[model samples]
Target chain A: MNKRKVYIFLGFSFAYLAGMFSSDIKSYFIKEVYSTEYGNLVFKCDQAMREHFIAKQVVAAKPNAEHASSLMQAEIALIDCQDYDLARKKLLSFGLNEYDLIELSLRAIEEKSEDIRKVVEIHEIRYD
Target chain B: MKFDTIKPFLCALAVWFVFAYTYEAAYAGLRDNTLIDAGKHFIYSTSLTPIDPNIKKASLGSKLFEDVRLSFNGKMSCALCHIDKFGSSDGLRNSIGIGGEGEGSERLDSDGLVVPRNSLPLWGRGESDFQTFFWDGKVEKEGGKVRSQFGDYAPSNDPLTVAIHLPFVEIREMVNDDYEVKSSLKTESVKSAEKIYDRLLERVKENQEYVSAFDELYFLKLDEIEFIHIADAIKVFIQSKFRLQKTRFEKYVKQESVLSPDEVAGGLIFFGKGKCVSCHSGRHFTDFKYHSIPFVQAGFGKNGFGVDYGRFNVTHDPDDLYKFRTPPLTNVEKTAPYGHSGSALTMEEAVIYHFDPLRLISTENMTPLERSEFYKKLLASSEDSELIPYLDDDEVDTLILFLKTLSYEESSE
Candidate 1:
């Protein structure tokens, strides 16, 4: 292929990829925020079980070693409502809040990708 | 040929960008608007938040409520019964309406007929969850449409009726003698009502304060004010007055120092096994749903009068008979005598009434009220053991202490 033609093709491909992944990237940030929030509302009604759900969503959405450690810490804090401070600390470390998390969970409904779709289901059921 | 082909491609991209930006902006604006519009319904749709954010609708609705000339008698407005300071209801068993000659529940002529049902207190009815109106939950449809007694459901595209409490005015006593009487969608009584209604509607149109407020909130002209619009404005005012945030129970939980030893015990009973929290959950202290208990009827002393029969009457479901909406206990102290009939005179009696409710309790042994035929019947009923379980006197006192805590928080704004 000609050098100019090759560069143009690559540029167009990059832009299409950016456009396609925009919503997913947004969803990842949203899921993290809402999982933290659903944690808070559920914590009000029940702390231990809510923490379990919270940890599950966190691990599923961001399956890195750091998040896995935070997920474990959230589970430990679930023993009491006063332990909300501990849960808040984990959520803050991830840069998310309850309202942001709720909006993210709602935003996930618009995503059509299967991999993203699976993660959204786990987050939503845990949310409910 | 080369220029023509390039020009079409460039133009397509430009159009796509423009269309995409516009679509996104419109979608976002619509979402925010939905939240704002539905937020009113979440609280109470009574007050309108002005689109301009400068004009206040509650203040305007308040002014309209205080205007006496808005009535057929040219003397009574909403404020006559719902005096602001007096808990938004006259402290009468029933309120004098239209012609204000005697006390509520007194022998007053209404088209020569006496009024039925007590003047229910006005607190908490402004809460968005409260769609049921009158002593009976008779006016609201599933979609929040106004289904009047003689009129068809207002059109769906129309605004929701502002005030859900209009059925209170349809009683014969509230209407004038000369008001034209109609049987179908026609009649002289209906015509006269339509005229007075139009007069009230005209007053709203003429008042610069209301015209300005409604315009600011709805973005519509004064001449465009529909009955639903007025109702919405009035509803906003009513709800703004009584937000029902907390009660003594919540206070005790927050301010541990205020709780007495008995209140603490009652608190355990309330949340642990007393099962009150099952129905009385949330900050408003009610699930805002209905339940049936065996409590004997009170109020107007008419059978099935105070009994709600729950969503069944609204849906005609047989399982819902005698089921009434669980009353929020925010201002329960002021909205007595309790239950659908004003049956229980004191909180203790209300508790005792809830204990068994199958047998009648005597009013004499339980608490003191002015003696009347209704009072006499209650006095006789209060003594029945089947109606009230023999609580060790301390248990009774503790429960009452817990209940008093369910009032609006003293420190609340």
Candidate 2:
């Protein structure tokens, strides 16, 4: 095909693809806020239930040596929203202490953050 | 001097011949030596690991396990088919669940719906290695997520917990298949399953004993409780109660135990020439994968026309047709009749049926329809199948003996 014809075909393909996935793309850009209330959470009921179950499991887990409750609550927060920022805030609100540095490292590791490799060393350097 | 030297040389030559002949005969007598090497090979192939479950929660879960209220009809429980006496299976060629009375053989007389496949034993299912569940592997942990009939909305992250949702909601198994019953449960969506779970939770909570017990056990506020909680608890319970104990095979692997000559030979045949390890590999005695072996159809299958297209029922892919999950064989001797149909009466029969299914199927007994249906099953299973190597009678006996070494007596109490 000539460049003019190729451009026309590509334009149509782009339009079709965008039209097909407009809602999915919209959903991804928006920060997901799941609710336990049935009406609000209807479509994502399964996700809400799974989050709640994870919360229960966190609560049931054996306590670590120090700052365990805060760590546990952090884990629950993460399960609820899976938003690291939100979970970190929740953890801080629960009162981060000696476990904060390590707990943060755990979350960073779980999320596979680019800064994860030196997390433990950084924590020790900061705290020690 | 010459005569003396010749005599000595002849005597030495005669002694060496006799010694060589005796050594060959001794080697013939100790044919079981190969079996020891086979045992070593078997040990190299499989490893056994034990699990730790929350004792308090598992105890509470045990109560829920036997509670008949788990079913919508109040007719069935997990215990109905997974009887302790029958190697944690129903001891039927095919399970007859719901609308059934009595246990084992007497269940046949009931007006219950016959679930097409044989009741699978729960042995080694609680193990982490046993990542998939059910005959078709509808609920499986794959690609770092639980996949199931629930699709994107699988009830839980844990596949076993997700698998727990199936039995109670299944129409023919736990819920009555009647139109009224179906309508009562609402439509067959993930929402429909949630609605049933909600109702079942209410029913469970209504029992004061369960309410107090669960409240104390899970340390939960009453409203926080849900059906997946029940599933999780039962999952823990199964894990705790059925964790791999030191089987004779495990002990033999560790060099802390010994196998009889027959058992060693059988173990050899299983791991080596038998080719069973091709499908039934690893610690759980399963690769936790699916393959077709042309098992005979029993009762009405999941699909009408006396035909069930196994994994195809789940995936609808032509390649997956006639495939069933290779079942773990931890306690094979007791969990008979074997095969997906429970068609093989004895372990020997089950082993033999792998190679020669026609030997087990009584042509005289099968109706024209059954025979035709079975032939269709054969055709579907013929291509790209798990290879079932031929076993002689002694080898079959030895295999059964080896299987017995995998079992240990259990106390539900």
Residues B234-274 of candidate 2 have per-residue lDDT tens digits of 99888887676667777776667777766765765565446
Q: Over all chains combined, what TM-score does candidate 2 have? A: 0.68
- DockQ (0 to 1) for model 1: 0.02
Task: Spell out the clash pairs found in candidate 2.
Answer: none
TM-scores for chain A over all candidates? 0.33, 0.27
- B-chain TM-scores per prediction: 0.63, 0.87
lDDT at residue B401 of model 1 (Cα atoms): 74
What does the lDDT come to for candidate 2? 0.70
Q: Label model 2 with its docking quality class.
A: incorrect
